[model samples]
Target: MNSNAIKARKKVLVILTQSPYGNALSREAIDYCLAAAAFEQDLTLLFTGDAVLQLINDQNPSTINQKDLTKTLSALPIYGINQFYVDSNALEQYGIDNDFCVPTIKVDVKEISELLVNADTILNF
Candidate 1:
């Protein structure tokens, strides 16, 4: 009921576990994050499972005539959504080197758990 509480922006965590290019889920999730960021919400984007692929650089989705999601992801900072976290296990599982990914914090499952617990709002895709 206090003014401060009423004006506070919720901490929103977006967990993306799907791969980009093959489907539209990643694109939609990115759109959601951007929309939430436009509202000035505290946003954090976690790339896990196959979603880690979205952070990889130099993707040429244009070969398949699909828009490059990684390119879109690189624009997140402009939207004020720069908190990027990647699951270390997923990176290893997919044989993806972190050097190929965008600016991100490689995290273990335990740290991911901590993030989920601290988030005020969580959206998974």
Candidate 2:
């Protein structure tokens, strides 16, 4: 099937490596997905590399002039974007876990890259 047709009947995966407050792209990407979910789109979120920082615990962010991404990540379920994922080695390298992040699957870079290629539409933020 073509890309739009695939997406129409399948899930959307968003891979985020950008931080919440350093720039607006990350936040915008998430907000756009929320909007997509609002439209009944099936959505999944994956965190890897530096993006794992988005799930770090208890970030007050005021000191760094950033919004608390943890809050946004925690709200995924309410928005129906609950199929979350994290690279296993990235979690080890970044020191994170399920409790500190959205419900996630353990995936490595190889599988992750494959997921991107296979996805009807892969969005990186």
Measured by TM-score, the strongest candidate is 1
TM-score of each: 0.91, 0.79
Which residue pairs clash within candidate 1? none
Score each candidate by Cα lDDT. Answer: 0.86, 0.75
What is the Cα-based lDDT of residue 56 in candidate 1? 81
The residue pairs that clash in candidate 2, if any, are none
lDDT string for model 2 (53-104, tens) is: 7776777988977777777767767877777677788788866665665666
lDDT of 1 by residue, 11-116 (tens): 8889998989877999999988878888888998899998998888878988999998877787788887767989999989989865654588889999999999
- Candidate 2's TM-score reads 0.79
